[model samples]
Target: MKKITALIGSAQKKATYEAVREFERNLKSHTEIELEYVFLADYQIEFCRGCKLCFNQGEKFCPLHDDRDLIIDKLIHSDGVIFATPNYAFHVSASMKNLLDRTAFFLHRPYFFGKAFTSIVTQGIYGGNSIIKYLKNMGENLGYSTSKGCVLKTLEPVTKDVQKKNSLKIKKAAARFNKVLMRQTAPSPSFFRLMMFRMSRSSMKEMLNDEYYDYQYYRKNGWFESDYYYEVSLNPIKKMMGRIFDYIGHRMAGMN
Candidate 1:
């Protein structure tokens, strides 16, 4: 059975967490996937100190050590990841953002590959959808196969219509998440994704070798010689775009 986890980003077990539980219940009932819930409030993740060590050197060089690795381990071991959060002032709560901030290096050196990711967001009034959008982008940065997220309204005086709508949305999102998690392989990288790999690898190879761990990582992963993060059949246009990105990288290197 595939392992799944919901990283809860709130401090209280409020209506926000209830929405996440609804997602888990639906997913569990539909599939054989093993599910776990992780509350970031329970972890001792320190605030990022802006040292840039994780990007410049390596994660091991990060200044403030805490449960960051433990969180990452949960992420790595899970086949599917769900980021559950209560929108706080129109954004993800500090707990969720802190986790993302700590994993900023992954944005450059993605490794999750075929793992699936989605979001379950709850809000009192507005911003739940926007928060889910942010989660989708972050999931991609971490190299997870992202799916459409679920947005739920948790304001008081719950109307019958609102509750019914949330139930449908929860079921729909769970079904989508389940389907993607069952997909054993990651989807083909898009043109922009390919360009990102080409530009970063080339820039690191030509410059920044002594400045960032990504340079060594690209070399070790053989990404310097490849067109995408993983092997995939690329169409002619995307291949051409990749070469153009490489040319741009060369130009940037020439300027250095």
Candidate 2:
């Protein structure tokens, strides 16, 4: 029997979680794949410190040592991985991005390389494709099989009717994903295909060296700094700034 791990991440405790849970439940009904879900909400993981300690220094695995290492250990052993996250500001949520950033520790590790992986991006209205593209690149560049991944977009106000339809769509997608999961081994690539793979790898290496993720960690005293790390940086400075500006504007309008 195949084993699967579903990495569920959410920042807002929103409706999308229900959808992901339903998708997992649906998958359980069909395949013999043993599924394990690691919900970020339940765990305490520190943000990546950007020190590259996991890669270069080789000191204690990750720069920010916390539950992330333990969570990753479980994911490493699973035959397949499923990343489920919500879309925020036209991309994946901060919690999900932090998790991805921490994966730099395993960049050279064989655990994730060439492993089957999929993704689910739940959003209120738009940006599912953008988030999905981000995850697809992560899979391809990190050596995970990209063929099994998928993206799902949900309606803004999730009602019963929307939930029913969305659940059915997710079930169908999961079924399709299970087919790929069953066949763990990849078929041999022809000479031309092999050449293409080589070329793709070279290109991906170049792009990854630039590393575009902007991850922020917070101190225990609610201060923002690179070295200060927390499991989840809830209400980041950017979000807080937006709220502050909104509050000022609302007060001025009231005075007017």
Candidate 3:
């Protein structure tokens, strides 16, 4: 039996809870695989301090000892990790964010090195794709073999129609994840480590150089800098003024 750990990352509330319940219903279809569910709402996790203790100083333990340790242990022991969350503001909920922050404990740990991962994201409005992409990127960064993602958008009170659609998607995603986990072969650590190190360096440089850094670079390249700021500063005011004019015109037309 393949051991699988599913991390339920939504904050325990009405809509998110409903989505979770629906997902659970779908998961039951696969009775052959041994499954365990870990809920983030039940635990108290702290923000990562950026201490780098797991990699730089200590014996691979996160600086803040909290519920994250147990979660990490479960993930390490499992052959597959399934991340499920509700999309909030085009990303994951606060609970999911906090849990992600805690994963710093396993920065250099071999437990998550090349383990299979699948993501399931539910969004009330738009932007489910963004949330799925974000989780998938994180999974890959942690040396997890990522499977196909599951996305749900515009979910309200869980109706039977929505449930049926999501059930099939979740079941298929879980099956695919299990198949990858059952594969005995794992990725090479030394090669992955070197590639990850290089990627990190490049990504860090790009991140540190945001708008301000871009402005500087463009200025150096003889691109007029003041014009860029002028456009950025004027666009919002222009949009606001345009809306005001449109509203006034509509009222005037109604009066006529």
Winner by TM-score? 1
Please give the CA lDDT of all the candidate structures: 0.87, 0.60, 0.62
Q: Candidate 1: give its CA RMSD in angstroms.
A: 1.4
Q: Rank the candidates by lDDT, best first.
A: 1, 3, 2
Stretches of model 1 off by over 4 angstroms after superposition: none
What value does the lDDT take at residue 56 in candidate 2? 52
Task: Using lDDT, give the best candidate's number.
Answer: 1
Whichever of 1 and 3 has more lDDT, that candidate is 1
> Candidate 3 on 142-176: residue-level lDDT in tens?
76877777887536666888778776777777667
Q: What TM-score does candidate 2 get on C-alpha atoms? A: 0.66
Q: Which ten residues in a row have the lowest lDDT in candidate 3?
A: 223-232
- Enumerate residue pairs that collide in model 3: none
**RMSD in Å for all candidates:** 1.4, 16.5, 16.1
Per-residue accuracy of model 2 over 1-256 as CA lDDT, tens digit each = 6778878777555555666677677777777768787778777767776776565534364546578777778877887778888778888777777777877644443236446777888877777887777886676555566554445556565687867767777887678667666664553433332333333333333333323221111112232221111122323654454344444544544554
- Candidate 1 lDDT over residue span 26-84, tens digit each: 99887887888899999999999998889878999998879999999998999989999
lDDT value for candidate 2? 0.60
Q: Lowest-scoring 10 consecutive residues by lDDT in candidate 2?
A: 212-221
